[model samples]
Target: MSAALALRQAIHDRLAADAPLAALAGAVRIHDVPPADVAFPFVILGEAVVADWSTATEGGTEQSLTLHAFSRAGGRREAFALAAAIQEALHDAPLALAGHRLANLRATTAEVRREGDGRTYHALVRFRAVTEPL
Candidate 1:
């Protein structure tokens, strides 16, 4: 499996398994896109971009992942709280990738914005992760 795919799955699985994440979001709902059957207050594995970070003797990759939090708690506070849980869950997280080793993972930035729809809050968390072949 490719590093990007493994890392993405690892991330999703880690968040889904975290107790705090579930408590903060009433069950950590993580998906590339939330299922139509599901309601608001969930986490979306928004997008992932991978680049080569190889060295002479080692194969390395750097992945940028964007995680989005959506909530309908009457304000941005709930969304922001969820984002914090996500950051804490992922920052320097010890992810176990099938074909790769997670060298490092760090939360880059988080921003809270009221969606134009006016009924939802959008919180975006950017993460930088580095991986190498096992």
Candidate 2:
């Protein structure tokens, strides 16, 4: 598999197996594409941008991954809390990618805001990762 795909699979597995995160967002609430009637305080795997980072001797890739947390709580607190949990779960996480070596992973940016709908809060956490063929 491509490095980006491997890395994404590894991340999704890690997040799904995280007990603390499950406690906060509820089991089965993390999704690649959430259902139309998904529950609150759920996490969605968002966009991913991948770029070639190969050297003369080795092939590699750099990836930017985004995760979204949605909440309908009365305040931004729930969204922020979910974002923090996601950061803690992913930043510097030692994920084992299929057919690839995870060289590095880190949380790069995060934003929490009230959506235009005015009742929902959205939290976006972005991560950077480097991977190489194993």
Consecutive 10-residue window with the lowest summed lDDT within model 2? 21-30
lDDT per model vs. reference: 0.91, 0.89
Residues 1-134 of candidate 2: C-alpha lDDT, one tens digit per residue: 88877887888888888887888777637788988988787888889999999999999999999999999988899888889889998999989999999999999999999999999999999999999899
Candidate 1 C-alpha error for residue 48, in Å: 1.0
lDDT of 2 at 126: 97
* Pairs in clash, predicted candidate 2: none
CA lDDT of 28 in candidate 1?
Answer: 75
Task: Identify the leading candidate in terms of lDDT.
Answer: 1
Cα displacement (Å) at residue 5, model 2: 1.6
What residue pairs clash in candidate 1, if any at all?
Answer: none
